[model samples]
Target: MVDVMHQEVVALENRRRLYTGLAVVLLIAVVMSGYHEASQLNSGGFLQGLAKFFDYPAQIVAQSWEDGWAFWALFPKFLPALIETLNIAAVATIIGALIATVLSLLSSRNLEVPAAMIPVVRRIMDVMRAFPELIIALFLIFVLGASPVPAAIAVAFHTSGALGKLFSEVNENIDVKPLEGLKATGSTWLQRVRFGVLPQVLPNYSSYFLLRFEINVRASAILGFVGAGGIGSELSRAIGWGAGNEIAALFLLLFLSIVAIDQLSSYLRRHFVGAESFG
Candidate 1:
Protein backbone atom coordinates (compact mmCIF):
# COMPACT_ATOMS: atom_id res chain seq x y z
CA MET A 1 0.00 0.00 0.00
CA VAL A 2 2.85 2.41 0.78
CA ASP A 3 4.54 1.73 -2.58
CA VAL A 4 1.26 2.12 -4.48
CA MET A 5 0.56 5.51 -2.82
CA HIS A 6 4.11 6.62 -3.59
CA GLN A 7 3.67 5.71 -7.27
CA GLU A 8 0.43 7.77 -7.47
CA VAL A 9 2.22 10.78 -5.98
CA VAL A 10 5.01 10.44 -8.53
CA ALA A 11 2.51 10.26 -11.41
CA LEU A 12 0.66 13.38 -10.13
CA GLU A 13 3.95 15.28 -9.86
CA ASN A 14 4.84 14.32 -13.45
CA ARG A 15 1.50 15.66 -14.74
CA ARG A 16 1.91 18.94 -12.82
CA ARG A 17 5.41 19.40 -14.21
CA LEU A 18 4.24 18.70 -17.78
CA TYR A 19 1.36 21.19 -17.43
CA THR A 20 3.67 23.87 -16.01
CA GLY A 21 6.12 23.50 -18.87
CA LEU A 22 3.36 23.78 -21.52
CA ALA A 23 1.91 26.86 -19.82
CA VAL A 24 5.31 28.54 -19.78
CA VAL A 25 5.81 27.78 -23.48
CA LEU A 26 2.34 29.18 -24.34
CA LEU A 27 2.99 32.34 -22.32
CA ILE A 28 6.33 32.86 -24.08
CA ALA A 29 4.70 32.43 -27.52
CA VAL A 30 1.89 34.92 -26.73
CA VAL A 31 4.36 37.48 -25.35
CA MET A 32 6.57 37.12 -28.44
CA SER A 33 3.59 37.64 -30.77
CA GLY A 34 2.46 40.73 -28.88
CA TYR A 35 6.01 42.12 -28.89
CA HIS A 36 6.30 41.60 -32.64
CA GLU A 37 3.03 43.46 -33.32
CA ALA A 38 3.97 46.24 -30.90
CA SER A 39 7.34 46.67 -32.55
CA GLN A 40 5.72 46.96 -35.97
CA LEU A 41 3.43 49.68 -34.58
CA ASN A 42 6.42 51.58 -33.12
CA SER A 43 6.43 50.21 -29.59
CA GLY A 44 9.41 52.47 -28.75
CA GLY A 45 6.89 55.34 -28.55
CA PHE A 46 4.29 53.38 -26.58
CA LEU A 47 4.54 55.72 -23.61
CA GLN A 48 3.61 58.71 -25.77
CA GLY A 49 0.59 56.85 -27.20
CA LEU A 50 -0.62 55.92 -23.70
CA ALA A 51 -0.22 59.51 -22.54
CA LYS A 52 -2.27 60.83 -25.46
CA PHE A 53 -5.17 58.40 -24.95
CA PHE A 54 -5.81 59.41 -21.32
CA ASP A 55 -4.74 63.06 -21.69
CA TYR A 56 -6.98 63.80 -24.66
CA PRO A 57 -10.11 62.27 -23.11
CA ALA A 58 -9.33 63.96 -19.80
CA GLN A 59 -8.93 67.41 -21.33
CA ILE A 60 -12.13 67.00 -23.34
CA VAL A 61 -14.36 65.50 -20.63
CA ALA A 62 -13.11 67.92 -17.96
CA GLN A 63 -13.81 71.06 -19.97
CA SER A 64 -17.10 69.70 -21.29
CA TRP A 65 -18.66 68.68 -17.99
CA GLU A 66 -17.58 71.76 -16.05
CA ASP A 67 -20.90 71.67 -14.23
CA GLY A 68 -22.57 68.26 -13.76
CA TRP A 69 -25.94 69.92 -14.35
CA ALA A 70 -24.90 71.09 -17.82
CA PHE A 71 -24.88 67.49 -19.06
CA TRP A 72 -28.43 66.87 -17.85
CA ALA A 73 -29.58 70.24 -19.15
CA LEU A 74 -28.51 69.20 -22.64
CA PHE A 75 -30.64 66.08 -22.53
CA PRO A 76 -33.62 67.76 -24.18
CA LYS A 77 -31.55 68.64 -27.21
CA PHE A 78 -30.44 65.04 -27.67
CA LEU A 79 -33.85 63.51 -26.98
CA PRO A 80 -35.08 63.68 -30.55
CA ALA A 81 -31.92 62.14 -31.94
CA LEU A 82 -32.03 59.49 -29.24
CA ILE A 83 -35.57 58.58 -30.26
CA GLU A 84 -34.48 58.36 -33.87
CA THR A 85 -31.68 55.97 -32.95
CA LEU A 86 -34.09 53.83 -30.97
CA ASN A 87 -36.42 53.75 -33.96
CA ILE A 88 -33.56 52.57 -36.18
CA ALA A 89 -32.78 49.75 -33.78
CA ALA A 90 -36.43 48.69 -33.41
CA VAL A 91 -37.20 48.68 -37.09
CA ALA A 92 -33.98 46.89 -37.92
CA THR A 93 -34.49 44.24 -35.27
CA ILE A 94 -38.08 43.41 -36.25
CA ILE A 95 -37.41 43.33 -40.00
CA GLY A 96 -34.18 41.42 -39.63
CA ALA A 97 -35.66 38.88 -37.22
CA LEU A 98 -38.49 38.13 -39.62
CA ILE A 99 -36.16 37.57 -42.56
CA ALA A 100 -33.67 35.63 -40.48
CA THR A 101 -36.38 33.15 -39.48
CA VAL A 102 -36.66 32.03 -43.06
CA LEU A 103 -32.96 32.07 -43.85
CA SER A 104 -32.12 30.18 -40.66
CA LEU A 105 -34.42 27.32 -41.61
CA LEU A 106 -32.61 27.11 -44.92
CA SER A 107 -29.15 27.40 -43.41
CA SER A 108 -29.58 24.86 -40.60
CA ARG A 109 -27.41 21.82 -41.40
CA ASN A 110 -29.63 19.41 -39.50
CA LEU A 111 -32.60 20.28 -41.70
CA GLU A 112 -33.06 18.37 -44.94
CA VAL A 113 -32.12 20.26 -48.09
CA PRO A 114 -30.98 19.40 -51.58
CA ALA A 115 -27.37 18.26 -51.11
CA ALA A 116 -26.24 20.32 -54.10
CA MET A 117 -27.44 23.62 -52.58
CA ILE A 118 -26.06 23.22 -49.05
CA PRO A 119 -22.52 24.50 -49.59
CA VAL A 120 -23.69 27.39 -51.76
CA VAL A 121 -26.20 28.72 -49.23
CA ARG A 122 -23.87 28.23 -46.25
CA ARG A 123 -21.01 30.08 -47.99
CA ILE A 124 -23.27 33.01 -48.79
CA MET A 125 -24.27 33.37 -45.14
CA ASP A 126 -20.62 33.06 -44.10
CA VAL A 127 -19.67 35.95 -46.38
CA MET A 128 -22.51 38.13 -45.07
CA ARG A 129 -21.68 37.63 -41.39
CA ALA A 130 -17.90 37.84 -42.00
CA PHE A 131 -18.06 41.53 -43.01
CA PRO A 132 -18.07 43.99 -40.12
CA GLU A 133 -21.21 46.07 -39.46
CA LEU A 134 -19.40 49.36 -40.11
CA ILE A 135 -18.26 48.16 -43.52
CA ILE A 136 -21.84 47.25 -44.38
CA ALA A 137 -22.91 50.72 -43.21
CA LEU A 138 -20.34 52.29 -45.52
CA PHE A 139 -21.50 50.25 -48.48
CA LEU A 140 -25.16 51.01 -47.74
CA ILE A 141 -24.29 54.69 -47.47
CA PHE A 142 -22.88 54.59 -51.00
CA VAL A 143 -25.81 52.70 -52.45
CA LEU A 144 -28.64 54.52 -50.68
CA GLY A 145 -26.98 57.93 -50.20
CA ALA A 146 -26.68 59.72 -46.88
CA SER A 147 -29.73 59.66 -44.59
CA PRO A 148 -31.50 57.57 -41.97
CA VAL A 149 -32.35 55.33 -44.90
CA PRO A 150 -28.78 54.20 -45.26
CA ALA A 151 -28.36 53.78 -41.50
CA ALA A 152 -31.47 51.59 -41.26
CA ILE A 153 -30.35 49.61 -44.28
CA ALA A 154 -26.95 49.02 -42.73
CA VAL A 155 -28.48 48.06 -39.40
CA ALA A 156 -30.89 45.68 -41.12
CA PHE A 157 -28.09 43.95 -43.03
CA HIS A 158 -26.02 43.63 -39.87
CA THR A 159 -28.97 42.36 -37.85
CA SER A 160 -29.85 39.85 -40.58
CA GLY A 161 -26.36 38.40 -40.75
CA ALA A 162 -25.92 38.12 -37.00
CA LEU A 163 -29.47 36.98 -36.21
CA GLY A 164 -29.54 34.40 -39.01
CA LYS A 165 -26.43 32.66 -37.68
CA LEU A 166 -27.85 32.74 -34.16
CA PHE A 167 -31.21 31.48 -35.39
CA SER A 168 -29.49 28.52 -37.06
CA GLU A 169 -27.75 27.71 -33.81
CA VAL A 170 -31.06 27.79 -31.96
CA ASN A 171 -32.57 25.47 -34.54
CA GLU A 172 -29.64 23.11 -34.17
CA ASN A 173 -30.13 22.80 -30.40
CA ILE A 174 -33.83 21.82 -30.61
CA ASP A 175 -35.10 18.48 -29.17
CA VAL A 176 -35.28 15.83 -31.94
CA LYS A 177 -38.22 13.85 -30.52
CA PRO A 178 -40.85 16.28 -31.72
CA LEU A 179 -39.40 16.11 -35.20
CA GLU A 180 -39.65 12.31 -35.26
CA GLY A 181 -43.21 12.37 -33.90
CA LEU A 182 -44.24 14.86 -36.56
CA LYS A 183 -42.62 12.66 -39.19
CA ALA A 184 -44.53 9.61 -37.90
CA THR A 185 -47.78 11.57 -38.26
CA GLY A 186 -47.38 11.33 -42.05
CA SER A 187 -46.82 15.06 -42.21
CA THR A 188 -45.23 16.75 -45.17
CA TRP A 189 -41.90 18.58 -44.77
CA LEU A 190 -43.62 21.95 -44.43
CA GLN A 191 -46.07 20.65 -41.81
CA ARG A 192 -43.30 19.01 -39.79
CA VAL A 193 -41.21 22.18 -39.85
CA ARG A 194 -44.16 24.37 -38.98
CA PHE A 195 -45.46 22.19 -36.10
CA GLY A 196 -42.40 20.42 -34.79
CA VAL A 197 -39.29 22.55 -35.36
CA LEU A 198 -40.74 26.01 -34.88
CA PRO A 199 -42.31 25.46 -31.45
CA GLN A 200 -39.21 24.03 -29.74
CA VAL A 201 -36.82 26.64 -31.11
CA LEU A 202 -39.12 29.65 -30.71
CA PRO A 203 -37.99 30.46 -27.19
CA ASN A 204 -34.29 30.40 -27.99
CA TYR A 205 -34.99 32.25 -31.24
CA SER A 206 -36.63 35.11 -29.32
CA SER A 207 -33.59 35.33 -27.03
CA TYR A 208 -31.20 35.63 -29.97
CA PHE A 209 -33.34 38.27 -31.72
CA LEU A 210 -33.57 40.41 -28.59
CA LEU A 211 -29.85 40.10 -27.93
CA ARG A 212 -29.04 41.15 -31.49
CA PHE A 213 -31.41 44.10 -31.07
CA GLU A 214 -29.19 45.27 -28.20
CA ILE A 215 -26.09 45.10 -30.39
CA ASN A 216 -27.84 46.91 -33.25
CA VAL A 217 -28.74 49.78 -30.89
CA ARG A 218 -25.05 50.32 -30.19
CA ALA A 219 -23.90 49.81 -33.80
CA SER A 220 -26.47 52.26 -35.24
CA ALA A 221 -24.99 55.00 -33.04
CA ILE A 222 -21.67 54.66 -34.89
CA LEU A 223 -23.23 54.33 -38.33
CA GLY A 224 -22.99 58.09 -38.73
CA PHE A 225 -19.19 57.77 -39.06
CA VAL A 226 -19.96 56.29 -42.49
CA GLY A 227 -22.71 58.84 -43.36
CA ALA A 228 -25.53 56.59 -42.20
CA GLY A 229 -27.56 59.20 -40.36
CA GLY A 230 -28.51 58.37 -36.78
CA ILE A 231 -27.43 59.43 -33.31
CA GLY A 232 -23.91 58.35 -34.31
CA SER A 233 -23.86 60.95 -37.08
CA GLU A 234 -24.85 63.62 -34.60
CA LEU A 235 -22.28 62.37 -32.09
CA SER A 236 -19.54 62.39 -34.72
CA ARG A 237 -20.52 65.90 -35.78
CA ALA A 238 -20.46 67.13 -32.19
CA ILE A 239 -16.91 65.83 -31.82
CA GLY A 240 -15.86 67.22 -35.22
CA TRP A 241 -17.00 70.74 -34.35
CA GLY A 242 -15.25 70.58 -30.96
CA ALA A 243 -18.43 70.60 -28.90
CA GLY A 244 -17.01 68.50 -26.12
CA ASN A 245 -19.95 69.49 -23.93
CA GLU A 246 -22.39 68.10 -26.48
CA ILE A 247 -20.31 64.99 -26.86
CA ALA A 248 -20.37 64.53 -23.09
CA ALA A 249 -24.14 64.86 -23.17
CA LEU A 250 -24.26 62.24 -25.92
CA PHE A 251 -22.06 59.87 -23.92
CA LEU A 252 -24.29 60.08 -20.86
CA LEU A 253 -27.35 59.63 -23.06
CA LEU A 254 -25.85 56.59 -24.81
CA PHE A 255 -24.98 54.91 -21.52
CA LEU A 256 -28.45 55.45 -20.05
CA SER A 257 -30.29 54.42 -23.22
CA ILE A 258 -28.27 51.27 -23.79
CA VAL A 259 -28.70 50.24 -20.16
CA ALA A 260 -32.45 50.68 -20.32
CA ILE A 261 -32.72 48.77 -23.57
CA ASP A 262 -30.57 45.95 -22.22
CA GLN A 263 -32.70 45.52 -19.12
CA LEU A 264 -35.94 45.60 -21.07
CA SER A 265 -34.63 43.10 -23.59
CA SER A 266 -33.48 40.75 -20.84
CA TYR A 267 -36.88 40.90 -19.16
CA LEU A 268 -38.77 40.23 -22.37
CA ARG A 269 -36.54 37.33 -23.37
CA ARG A 270 -36.83 35.68 -19.96
CA HIS A 271 -40.57 36.11 -19.99
CA PHE A 272 -40.94 34.73 -23.52
CA VAL A 273 -38.76 31.70 -22.79
CA GLY A 274 -41.01 30.92 -19.79
CA ALA A 275 -38.27 31.62 -17.28
CA GLU A 276 -40.20 34.52 -15.70
CA SER A 277 -42.80 37.09 -16.57
CA PHE A 278 -42.68 40.86 -16.27
CA GLY A 279 -43.59 42.24 -12.87
Candidate 2:
Protein backbone atom coordinates (compact mmCIF):
# COMPACT_ATOMS: atom_id res chain seq x y z
CA MET A 1 0.00 0.00 0.00
CA VAL A 2 2.85 2.40 0.84
CA ASP A 3 4.64 1.59 -2.43
CA VAL A 4 1.42 2.19 -4.41
CA MET A 5 0.83 5.53 -2.69
CA HIS A 6 4.46 6.61 -3.30
CA GLN A 7 4.15 5.77 -6.99
CA GLU A 8 0.96 7.89 -7.28
CA VAL A 9 2.62 10.86 -5.59
CA VAL A 10 5.67 10.54 -7.84
CA ALA A 11 3.49 10.43 -10.95
CA LEU A 12 1.60 13.59 -9.85
CA GLU A 13 4.88 15.40 -9.18
CA ASN A 14 6.23 14.39 -12.62
CA ARG A 15 3.03 15.60 -14.33
CA ARG A 16 3.24 18.94 -12.54
CA ARG A 17 6.88 19.37 -13.58
CA LEU A 18 6.01 18.49 -17.17
CA TYR A 19 3.24 21.12 -17.29
CA THR A 20 5.48 23.77 -15.68
CA GLY A 21 8.30 23.10 -18.15
CA LEU A 22 5.98 23.36 -21.14
CA ALA A 23 4.49 26.62 -19.84
CA VAL A 24 7.96 28.13 -19.38
CA VAL A 25 9.00 27.17 -22.92
CA LEU A 26 5.79 28.69 -24.32
CA LEU A 27 6.41 31.94 -22.42
CA ILE A 28 9.99 32.18 -23.71
CA ALA A 29 8.86 31.56 -27.28
CA VAL A 30 6.18 34.26 -27.07
CA VAL A 31 8.63 36.78 -25.63
CA MET A 32 11.23 36.06 -28.35
CA SER A 33 8.63 36.34 -31.12
CA GLY A 34 7.32 39.64 -29.73
CA TYR A 35 10.81 41.04 -29.44
CA HIS A 36 11.63 39.97 -32.99
CA GLU A 37 8.50 41.66 -34.35
CA ALA A 38 9.24 44.84 -32.41
CA SER A 39 12.83 44.93 -33.64
CA GLN A 40 11.63 44.61 -37.24
CA LEU A 41 9.12 47.44 -36.76
CA ASN A 42 11.67 49.71 -35.07
CA SER A 43 13.50 52.16 -37.37
CA GLY A 44 17.05 51.02 -36.60
CA GLY A 45 16.37 47.68 -34.91
CA PHE A 46 16.61 47.07 -31.16
CA LEU A 47 20.37 46.43 -31.02
CA GLN A 48 21.21 49.58 -33.03
CA GLY A 49 18.99 51.76 -30.84
CA LEU A 50 20.39 50.13 -27.68
CA ALA A 51 23.94 51.05 -28.71
CA LYS A 52 23.12 54.74 -29.01
CA PHE A 53 20.75 54.88 -26.00
CA PHE A 54 23.26 56.84 -23.91
CA ASP A 55 24.19 59.37 -26.64
CA TYR A 56 21.33 61.80 -25.89
CA PRO A 57 22.02 61.64 -22.16
CA ALA A 58 25.72 62.30 -22.81
CA GLN A 59 24.91 65.37 -24.91
CA ILE A 60 22.49 66.73 -22.29
CA VAL A 61 25.07 66.27 -19.54
CA ALA A 62 27.89 67.85 -21.54
CA GLN A 63 25.80 70.87 -22.48
CA SER A 64 24.49 71.32 -18.98
CA TRP A 65 28.01 71.21 -17.61
CA GLU A 66 29.14 73.86 -20.12
CA ASP A 67 26.23 76.11 -19.13
CA GLY A 68 26.17 75.24 -15.44
CA TRP A 69 25.19 78.78 -14.38
CA ALA A 70 22.29 78.90 -16.81
CA PHE A 71 21.13 75.48 -15.64
CA TRP A 72 21.04 76.78 -12.07
CA ALA A 73 19.15 79.89 -13.18
CA LEU A 74 16.46 77.80 -14.87
CA PHE A 75 15.32 76.46 -11.49
CA PRO A 76 13.74 79.76 -10.35
CA LYS A 77 12.03 80.24 -13.71
CA PHE A 78 10.71 76.67 -13.65
CA LEU A 79 9.49 76.72 -10.04
CA PRO A 80 5.99 77.84 -10.94
CA ALA A 81 5.54 75.02 -13.42
CA LEU A 82 6.76 72.54 -10.82
CA ILE A 83 4.20 73.94 -8.40
CA GLU A 84 1.47 73.57 -11.02
CA THR A 85 2.35 69.91 -11.55
CA LEU A 86 2.29 69.27 -7.81
CA ASN A 87 -1.05 71.05 -7.50
CA ILE A 88 -2.56 68.89 -10.22
CA ALA A 89 -1.36 65.71 -8.51
CA ALA A 90 -2.61 66.85 -5.12
CA VAL A 91 -6.07 67.79 -6.36
CA ALA A 92 -6.45 64.59 -8.30
CA THR A 93 -5.36 62.39 -5.41
CA ILE A 94 -7.68 64.03 -2.91
CA ILE A 95 -10.76 63.93 -5.15
CA GLY A 96 -10.03 60.46 -6.45
CA ALA A 97 -9.41 59.02 -2.98
CA LEU A 98 -12.74 60.35 -1.76
CA ILE A 99 -14.56 58.81 -4.70
CA ALA A 100 -12.65 55.55 -4.30
CA THR A 101 -13.69 55.29 -0.64
CA VAL A 102 -17.37 55.46 -1.53
CA LEU A 103 -17.05 53.11 -4.48
CA SER A 104 -15.00 50.62 -2.44
CA LEU A 105 -17.69 50.34 0.20
CA LEU A 106 -20.38 49.91 -2.41
CA SER A 107 -18.43 47.28 -4.34
CA SER A 108 -17.08 45.23 -1.46
CA ARG A 109 -18.96 41.92 -1.23
CA ASN A 110 -19.04 41.88 2.54
CA LEU A 111 -20.01 45.51 3.09
CA GLU A 112 -22.15 46.29 0.03
CA VAL A 113 -25.68 47.26 1.03
CA PRO A 114 -27.53 46.18 -2.10
CA ALA A 115 -25.52 43.00 -2.82
CA ALA A 116 -26.62 43.23 -6.45
CA MET A 117 -24.53 46.36 -7.09
CA ILE A 118 -21.20 44.58 -6.59
CA PRO A 119 -20.81 43.49 -10.19
CA VAL A 120 -22.04 46.82 -11.48
CA VAL A 121 -19.63 48.81 -9.34
CA ARG A 122 -16.74 46.45 -10.08
CA ARG A 123 -17.35 46.75 -13.82
CA ILE A 124 -17.46 50.52 -13.61
CA MET A 125 -14.09 50.52 -11.82
CA ASP A 126 -12.72 48.16 -14.48
CA VAL A 127 -13.74 50.51 -17.26
CA MET A 128 -12.34 53.48 -15.42
CA ARG A 129 -9.01 51.75 -14.87
CA ALA A 130 -8.79 50.30 -18.36
CA PHE A 131 -8.07 53.67 -20.00
CA PRO A 132 -4.62 55.08 -19.36
CA GLU A 133 -4.42 58.58 -17.88
CA LEU A 134 -2.55 59.87 -20.97
CA ILE A 135 -5.37 58.81 -23.33
CA ILE A 136 -7.95 60.44 -21.09
CA ALA A 137 -5.87 63.59 -20.80
CA LEU A 138 -5.44 63.86 -24.59
CA PHE A 139 -9.18 63.56 -25.17
CA LEU A 140 -9.95 66.05 -22.45
CA ILE A 141 -7.26 68.44 -23.72
CA PHE A 142 -9.01 68.47 -27.12
CA VAL A 143 -12.28 69.41 -25.46
CA LEU A 144 -10.96 71.48 -22.54
CA GLY A 145 -8.23 73.29 -24.51
CA ALA A 146 -4.88 72.42 -22.93
CA SER A 147 -4.85 73.19 -19.23
CA PRO A 148 -3.99 71.57 -15.91
CA VAL A 149 -7.70 70.94 -15.43
CA PRO A 150 -7.70 68.10 -17.94
CA ALA A 151 -4.62 66.55 -16.38
CA ALA A 152 -6.15 66.63 -12.91
CA ILE A 153 -9.40 65.15 -14.14
CA ALA A 154 -7.60 62.42 -16.04
CA VAL A 155 -5.42 61.42 -13.08
CA ALA A 156 -8.38 61.53 -10.71
CA PHE A 157 -10.46 59.28 -12.97
CA HIS A 158 -7.75 56.64 -13.13
CA THR A 159 -6.89 57.01 -9.43
CA SER A 160 -10.46 56.36 -8.29
CA GLY A 161 -10.68 53.17 -10.31
CA ALA A 162 -7.30 51.84 -9.18
CA LEU A 163 -7.85 52.68 -5.51
CA GLY A 164 -11.43 51.41 -5.53
CA LYS A 165 -10.29 47.97 -6.61
CA LEU A 166 -7.57 47.93 -3.93
CA PHE A 167 -9.79 49.28 -1.16
CA SER A 168 -12.53 46.76 -1.96
CA GLU A 169 -10.04 43.94 -1.64
CA VAL A 170 -9.02 45.28 1.77
CA ASN A 171 -12.68 45.55 2.77
CA GLU A 172 -13.24 41.90 1.93
CA ASN A 173 -10.69 40.80 4.54
CA ILE A 174 -12.19 42.66 7.54
CA ASP A 175 -13.81 40.78 10.42
CA VAL A 176 -17.56 40.49 9.97
CA LYS A 177 -18.39 40.45 13.67
CA PRO A 178 -18.49 44.21 14.04
CA LEU A 179 -20.70 44.63 11.02
CA GLU A 180 -23.05 41.90 12.23
CA GLY A 181 -23.19 43.39 15.71
CA LEU A 182 -23.94 46.84 14.31
CA LYS A 183 -26.71 45.44 12.12
CA ALA A 184 -28.22 43.56 15.04
CA THR A 185 -28.57 46.84 16.91
CA GLY A 186 -30.57 48.28 13.98
CA SER A 187 -27.76 50.60 12.98
CA THR A 188 -28.00 52.11 9.54
CA TRP A 189 -25.77 50.74 6.80
CA LEU A 190 -23.76 53.94 6.66
CA GLN A 191 -23.38 53.95 10.41
CA ARG A 192 -22.14 50.37 10.41
CA VAL A 193 -19.66 51.01 7.64
CA ARG A 194 -18.44 54.21 9.23
CA PHE A 195 -17.81 52.65 12.62
CA GLY A 196 -16.99 49.07 11.68
CA VAL A 197 -15.32 49.13 8.28
CA LEU A 198 -13.49 52.44 8.19
CA PRO A 199 -11.40 51.87 11.31
CA GLN A 200 -10.14 48.48 10.17
CA VAL A 201 -9.22 49.56 6.66
CA LEU A 202 -8.07 53.18 7.11
CA PRO A 203 -4.41 52.24 7.48
CA ASN A 204 -4.28 50.23 4.29
CA TYR A 205 -6.37 52.79 2.46
CA SER A 206 -4.09 55.63 3.48
CA SER A 207 -1.05 53.66 2.39
CA TYR A 208 -2.58 52.92 -0.97
CA PHE A 209 -3.71 56.53 -1.37
CA LEU A 210 -0.23 57.90 -0.74
CA LEU A 211 1.25 55.41 -3.19
CA ARG A 212 -1.32 56.43 -5.78
CA PHE A 213 -0.52 60.08 -5.18
CA GLU A 214 3.13 59.38 -5.93
CA ILE A 215 2.09 57.68 -9.17
CA ASN A 216 -0.27 60.55 -10.07
CA VAL A 217 2.49 63.09 -9.60
CA ARG A 218 4.49 61.35 -12.32
CA ALA A 219 1.37 60.93 -14.46
CA SER A 220 0.56 64.60 -14.12
CA ALA A 221 4.01 65.52 -15.41
CA ILE A 222 3.72 63.10 -18.35
CA LEU A 223 0.25 64.43 -19.22
CA GLY A 224 1.76 67.92 -19.34
CA PHE A 225 3.86 66.74 -22.31
CA VAL A 226 0.58 66.42 -24.20
CA GLY A 227 -0.13 70.14 -23.56
CA ALA A 228 -1.93 69.63 -20.28
CA GLY A 229 -0.01 72.67 -18.91
CA GLY A 230 2.52 71.82 -16.21
CA ILE A 231 6.23 71.20 -15.91
CA GLY A 232 5.92 68.48 -18.55
CA SER A 233 4.87 71.06 -21.18
CA GLU A 234 7.87 73.16 -20.28
CA LEU A 235 10.13 70.12 -20.53
CA SER A 236 8.62 69.28 -23.92
CA ARG A 237 9.30 72.84 -25.14
CA ALA A 238 12.92 72.66 -23.95
CA ILE A 239 13.42 69.39 -25.79
CA GLY A 240 11.75 70.68 -28.96
CA TRP A 241 14.05 73.73 -29.00
CA GLY A 242 17.10 71.58 -28.22
CA ALA A 243 17.79 73.49 -25.02
CA GLY A 244 19.97 70.84 -23.38
CA ASN A 245 20.76 72.98 -20.32
CA GLU A 246 17.08 73.72 -19.70
CA ILE A 247 16.26 70.06 -20.22
CA ALA A 248 18.86 69.04 -17.66
CA ALA A 249 17.53 71.56 -15.15
CA LEU A 250 13.95 70.39 -15.65
CA PHE A 251 15.00 66.78 -15.32
CA LEU A 252 16.82 67.60 -12.07
CA LEU A 253 13.79 69.38 -10.65
CA LEU A 254 11.48 66.52 -11.59
CA PHE A 255 13.88 63.92 -10.21
CA LEU A 256 14.26 65.79 -6.92
CA SER A 257 10.54 66.37 -6.55
CA ILE A 258 9.75 62.72 -7.21
CA VAL A 259 12.38 61.56 -4.78
CA ALA A 260 11.10 63.89 -2.06
CA ILE A 261 7.51 62.78 -2.56
CA ASP A 262 8.56 59.13 -2.63
CA GLN A 263 10.50 59.46 0.60
CA LEU A 264 7.72 61.30 2.41
CA SER A 265 5.04 58.89 1.21
CA SER A 266 7.15 55.88 2.11
CA TYR A 267 7.61 57.20 5.64
CA LEU A 268 3.91 57.93 6.07
CA ARG A 269 2.89 54.56 4.68
CA ARG A 270 5.28 52.82 7.03
CA HIS A 271 3.94 54.79 9.99
CA PHE A 272 0.32 54.02 9.15
CA VAL A 273 0.52 50.50 7.71
CA GLY A 274 3.56 49.24 9.63
CA ALA A 275 6.34 47.14 8.12
CA GLU A 276 4.97 43.93 9.59
CA SER A 277 1.67 44.30 7.72
CA PHE A 278 3.46 43.71 4.43
CA GLY A 279 5.15 40.58 5.71
Where does the lowest 10-residue lDDT sum fall in candidate 1? 43-52
C-alpha RMSD between model 1 and the true structure: 4.3
lDDT of each: 0.81, 0.93
Clashing pairs in 1: none
TM-score of each: 0.79, 0.86
Q: Which candidate is the best by TM-score?
A: 2
Residue ranges of candidate 2 with Cα displaced over 4 Å: 1-45, 276-279
* Total clashes for model 1: 0
Model 1, stretches more than 4 Å misplaced? 1-44, 276-279
Clashing pairs for predicted structure model 2, backbone only: none
Candidate 1 per-residue C-alpha lDDT over 18-102 given as tens digits, one digit per residue, 9 for 90 to 100: 9999999999999989977886789556666776778767866897768677667888988888888888888988988887787
What digit string (tens of lDDT, one per residue) describes model 2 on residues 1-279?
A: 999999999999999999999999999999999999998898899899889999999999999999857679889999999999999999999999999999999998888468788999999999999999999999999998999999999999999999999999999999999999999999998999889999999999999999998999999999989999889999999999998989999999999999999999988888998785332
TM-score of 2: 0.86
> What does candidate 2 score in Cα RMSD to the true structure?
3.2
